[model samples]
Target: MAKRISQDQIAKELGVSQSLVSLVLNGRREGVAEESYKMIWAAALKQGYVPRGGMHPMHAPDVQHSYVGVVMRAGLALAAQSNTFSHVSHGLFTALQHLNISLAFLGGEGDLDETKLFEVVSRRDPLLGIVILGEVKEPFMQALGELELKLVSVYASSPGLCHSIVPNDKQSVEQLVDHLVALGHTRFAWLGGNAKLGRNRLRLAALKERLAARDLLLDDRYVVNAEGAERQDGFDCAAELMRRAEGQNMPTAWVCHNGLIARGGLQFAYLRGIKVPGEISIAAVDRTRACTEIHPYLTSAASDPELIGAEAAKLLRSQPEEIGQWNKMFIDLVAPSLFEAGETSATRPE
Candidate 1:
C-alpha cells in the first residue's frame, strides 16, 4: 500500500500554515480566500491524500463519513413551507454541506416518535450529533435525553436540557417601539399573532414595557388579534381599524406582528386611498425578505433565520467531545436582529 500523505505534507507543499490546511481539510472555508482554497485542493489532489470516511479526498478523514441528524417537530414541518422555517433549514443544510457532513432528516409530520427517532439516529453508524428545530414536547425531550448523543435545540429552549439557539424577539420589539416613539407617534395600534404563542407574547410584553416607560399605553380597543400570522388576517384587522377610525381617532402608527401583516395592512390602506405615513405610518416587529421585496419597503425589525441556523450549526460543531458533559452543559444563545428603516416609516406628519 502507498504511504498515506499527511496534512503536514500538504501544508508544506502549499507553503501555508498547518492550521489553514487543517481548516480546508475539515471543510471549514468560511473565511478562507477562494484562491487559497483552490490551491489547497490542487495540492491535496497532487499529493494523493486519501480523506477518511469515504468522502472526497479534500475532506478531512474524521468528518467525511460522519452524519448529523436534524429532527423537525411535526408542527414545524407542517409550517416548513413558510419562508421563516425554510430559511433556517436552508442555513443549517448549507453549513453541513460545507463541513462535508452527511445529514439525516428523521422527523416531520409524525410528532417525532421516540423509538423511531432512536432507531434512525443509531442507524447512522457514525452520527456526530442531533439538532432539534421548533418546540419539542416534554415527552420527546425526555426520550432524547436518554440517547447519550450530542443535542442542540433551535427556536426553542428547555432549561438545562440542551444548547439553544433563538432570535432576540424582545429586543427587536423594543427597538421598533423606540423608533416609532422617536417619530412623535403617541397613539399606537398593535396587529399581532395569537397571544398564546410565546414569541408573540414576548413581543407584546416588550412593546407594553417600552410604551409604559414613555407614560403611554397600548389601547385595548386598537389591539387586533390576527389569530394566524397570515396576510388575510392582517387585511381584516386593518379594515376593522379603518371602520373604527371613522367613529373615533386613529392611531398615528400601526405596529404589525410581521412583514406579512404589514403588507396586508398596506394593501388595504392603498385600496381605500389612504396614503401610508400620510394617514398612518406602519412598521413591523418581525422582518423577512417580503419586507424588502415588496413595494414601499417595510420598515421592520428583522431577524435573520439564516443567522439563527448558522449559530445552531456552530454550537453543534463545537460540542465537547464528552457526550456526558452535554447533559450537564446549559447553553442559552440569542442572536440579535437588526432594524431596517425602509420607505414605509417616517416622522409624524403635521
Candidate 2:
C-alpha cells in the first residue's frame, strides 16, 4: 500500500506550518490571506494530498455546512456597550434557535488576530455563512470576501460585496423632524459622531434634508460633531456648540447620533444647570437604557435591534447552499419607530 499522504508532508514541502496546511485542508479560508491560501492549496494539489474526509467543496460535491459564525468588528470594550450591535445579537440568538442552526461567536476584532481567526475557523465544522455585527474596514472585508462563505452585515452595508440589513435613516429622520416641527421648534442642532463613517453621514444628511423640507435651516455653527464616540466627546462638543452659539441664535432642539452621546449631552445639561426638555429638547437616533439613566428618558427614532438581528438571521439562513448559486446582493432596510417622545422631547421653549 502506498504511504498515507499526511498534512505534515504538504506543510514541509511548501515551507508552511502543518497546522496551516490542516486549516486550509479543512475548508476554513475566511481569515487566510488570499495569496497564502492559493499557495497552500496549489501545493496540496501538486503533492496529491487529499483530505481524510474528501476534497475541497469547490472541487468536490457540495457539502451541507450548516454552522454560521458571528464576527464583531468592534473590540470587546466598544461591543459591550448596549448599542445597536448588542441588540442585533439578541435577535440573532432568538431567531437562530428556531432555524435549528448552530451559532458560533468567532471573536471581536481585538480578540482575533490573523492566526487566531484562522485557528478558530479551523476548529469548527465548515461554516456556511458569517454575520458581521458592525462596519468593517476594506482590507478586513476583502479577506472575508475571498472565502467561499456567504456574508450578512447588520447595521451596516458593504454595497456589492455582501448582503446587508440596516435601518432606514431617511424615514427615521423624517419622523423626528415632524415631531420637532409639531412642537413649534424650527431651529435644530445635531450632536453627532465622526463624519467619516457612512452611518453618521447618512444621519446628518437626512436631518439636513428633513429640516430643509420644513423650511428650517440647520445653521453650520449649531452642528457640532464629537471628536470621539465616547460620552466625554459629547460633553466637549456640547460645550463647543454652546460657546459658538453664544450671543447668536441657538438651536432649541438637539439630535444625537446614538444614546451614548445623547446621555453625554444630558450630563452636560445637568452640569450647566440646563433642564432637559425645559430649556432644550434632546433626542437620539439609536435607543439605549443608558439614555434613560438620567431623569428623563431619551426620545428616539430608531429601529429594533432584535428585529434587525432576526432579519439578518433569516437572510443568512436563506442563502443558497452552493456559493455559486448566490444572486444579486440583497439589502433589507428596516424603518425606525418613535419611542418615548413625551418623556424627553417636549413643546419648544418660548
The candidate maximizing lDDT is 1
Instruction: Residues 1-350, candidate 1: write the lDDT tens digits.
Output: 89998888898877889889889877887999988887887687667676655754335456555678788765554353344666777788788788877677776635567767656654425677888877767778878877877788887887788888888887788788889889998988888864556767777777888889989999887888777776887898898877776767788889888887888899999999988978788998765676877679988885788888887778778847633367887688888989988778788877
Model 2: how far residue 258 lies from native, Å: 0.9
Give one digit per residue, the lDDT tens place, for model 2 in 1-350: 66668889888888889998888877888888788788887677556565676555434344343567888875444447666777777788788776556678887755666666555545435676788877777777767766646788777888777888888877777777888888888889999975556788899999999999989899988888875666777787789889998987678898888887888888898899988888788888875566566667787877777888887787777747523354454565564555557467889887
How does model 1 fare in lDDT?
Answer: 0.78
Model 2: lDDT of residue 326: 49
Cα lDDT of all candidates, in order? 0.78, 0.76
Stretches off by above 4 angstroms in model 1 are 1-63, 78-82, 321-324
List ranges where model 2 is wrong by over 4 Å.
Answer: 1-66, 74-79, 100-102, 109-120, 291-295, 319-324, 332-342
